[model samples]
Target: MAIEHEQLERSSLTRYVSPKGDFIGFRDEDHYKEKLKEWGLSSGKGAKKEFLFKERNYQRVVTIKGYETYGKSDEFNTLVIEFQDGNLCCIHPAFLKEMQASSFGKESMLQVEEKDFSIEEQASETQEQVEKPEPKLEAKPEPKKPKATKPKKEKEPKIELPADKVHFTASVKQFALTYNPFNEENDEVVVLENVVIVEEPPIELGLAWCSHSKTLKKFELQPGDKLEFDGKVAKKKLAKGKDVEEEFIVDAAVQYKVNNPSKIVKNG
Candidate 1:
């Protein structure tokens, strides 16, 4: 017995709009990267199809090369993908690669119709009579001015930060937790506990230490308690023999928050 593969059509008979369309394929590598970016997947050069398909928002529809039929398993191939914003779809690796190798698909070959110029001529004649051309006037001409080009400002090189010096305060801004983490809990307890605004008062190294102690007492940070810090501070390394970089520390803390364990209550 011999095995035979189905022959794909040479031209596509179907049209597709983003999101609503039943088919999606990226001809341009950049477009494929954009789709991956939309899915929150990595768009790096090393990123691959298998990794992008893992995203939930990637979507695509497979068809028999140029055939109009879609979503029918018998007529078209399965295009595994995810759709987001109901606007764009991400094609699977197999489909994307195959489609890119294939021709521009059905987007080629625009339709053109023959037009009869007799109708246009009738309308033009019925409009009005042509007026005589106006006499040309010679006037004084002004000299051309020289064009000026503005110089572009060069971008500042990013500072090379040390390994340990990459402190949390170096972040552009403090991270925020907007979602209510304890909305579904049985009792209406505060999900976020003990928020402290450190790096305030006298700008001294001891200030952070004092605040750390206060935070430990107020929030009761256990072994695995989570804490967030936000602010900016310069990091300096000790130029010594052994504990040079490791011994260096900075002073900066804008805000901090923690999650508290549920409170226990006795039955009435």
Candidate 2:
């Protein structure tokens, strides 16, 4: 099936302009390399291989146009795959690894329980019986009234943040993985607590998240280490099960995300 524009937007996958001036989704560089090693695809770029792509119930052979990265940053890459009709899609490297054994599109299937089918079958049978019509109606018992409960307080609106970079001070809460739906993978992110804007913006964020990008990796940050940096903040909600990694669940809500943090200083 052709990927929809809305699906790509909801996935929050990064799109970049290739050298050929075409826009495509960028894959994680580290993940691509790891999959390559695991799959023993050591021949590197421009290597052609056949992948069995499952379209609905049938499978078709597609050509892997090898892997390519954007610019010198080595942060993200993409696997170019050509379909039988000569169309190309920038696929996640791990996706190809997954297709090796199992049929593709398995993850995209809507799972329905057998009980649901049984219920539908019973309803159909009842409808057929109703067609003959001679059953007497019985008086049904009145439904019990629900108990009175206190109303829940409305959630506070998220604060609007400045577009420009702001100086910040925050301490590392922990290091953990956050789920990325687009890639169907977990990304390493730094969980920060006690965050505060030290400059003119004057924003105080109790909890936040930042991706463990190459720049942050250089510091080798640990839990409890205090950091000072400049970054642009945006309102991004982090859902517990959907966005957070299972093992590293935070008690507090995360309402903001920090992007492109730079000039980092670590302190005890």
Candidate 3:
């Protein structure tokens, strides 16, 4: 059977088989890598990742080009993919990726450096004063004073968080409980994003990209789930190696009680 020639909005990650059940697919190659990024799976040859779907130790994920769809849009919608383990996890009824590209949307701007135009004015004023005559000064004797001890006041408590807040909606990229070596229970992580923020010359280079959100361990990350979370974020500057340039993104943290579970419209 032949695959369709059209592209669909893959919510970054998909697992579906063809209508004929003869082929398994993920999104296109670019999207597959994106899915891996969301899933926290690594395709780097040296990177070791424990295969969640297979009963194997940490293995290298060697991705390969695969099928997408085998039938019409109404009849069957899927993306095929191949894994290094030969496990073909195909997602059915794939939907095109729909998202509102976000903007840095700076509410306020900070001018870090203050221009010194007053220095030039001060210089001219100093020159004018120099042309004038100087006044004579007189000196006076001072009296001695006794030294006194000052009392210290009690210190107040320190609060880390500010009253201002923010939240963003994100989809579940990969939902899996990592395999534990010693215990039966496993941990989970979910990666979310808004979109690529182009570099603006005026804006700080760090604010150029979309916010980088890590997994909030509130609950299981379902494939069709779009979670809205409230948390505090800090700006982080990550410098690449000498050859590579540095990149900036915000680091978000969602405490257990901080984020109340809420859902939004999932991309079809």
Clashes of each: 7, 0, 14
Residues 166-255 of candidate 1 have per-residue lDDT tens digits of 112111111111211112111111122232333333222211111122223445433224444433222222111222232222223322
Which candidate should be chosen as best, given TM-score against the real structure?
2
Could you give me the TM-score of model 1 versus the true structure?
Answer: 0.15
Which numbered prediction scores highest in lDDT against the true structure?
2
C-alpha TM-score for every candidate: 0.15, 0.45, 0.18
Model 1 misplacement above 4 A:
1-4, 7-135, 141-170, 173-268
Q: Residue 117: error of model 1 in Å?
A: 23
Clashes of 1: 7
Task: Point out where model 2 deviates above 4 Å.
Answer: 1-158, 241-247
Give the backbone clash total of model 3.
14
lDDT of 2 by residue, 97-215 (tens): 55555645655322334667788999999998776767789999899899899899999866656666789999999876666654455667788999998766577888989878766
For candidate 2, the C-alpha RMSD (Å) to the true structure equals 11.2
What is the full ranking by TM-score, best candidate first?
2, 3, 1
> Considering summed lDDT, which 10 consecutive residues are worst modelled in model 1?
3-12
lDDT of 2: 0.65
Model 1 error, position 135 (Å): 9.7
lDDT by candidate, in order shown: 0.30, 0.65, 0.33
Ranking by lDDT: 2, 3, 1
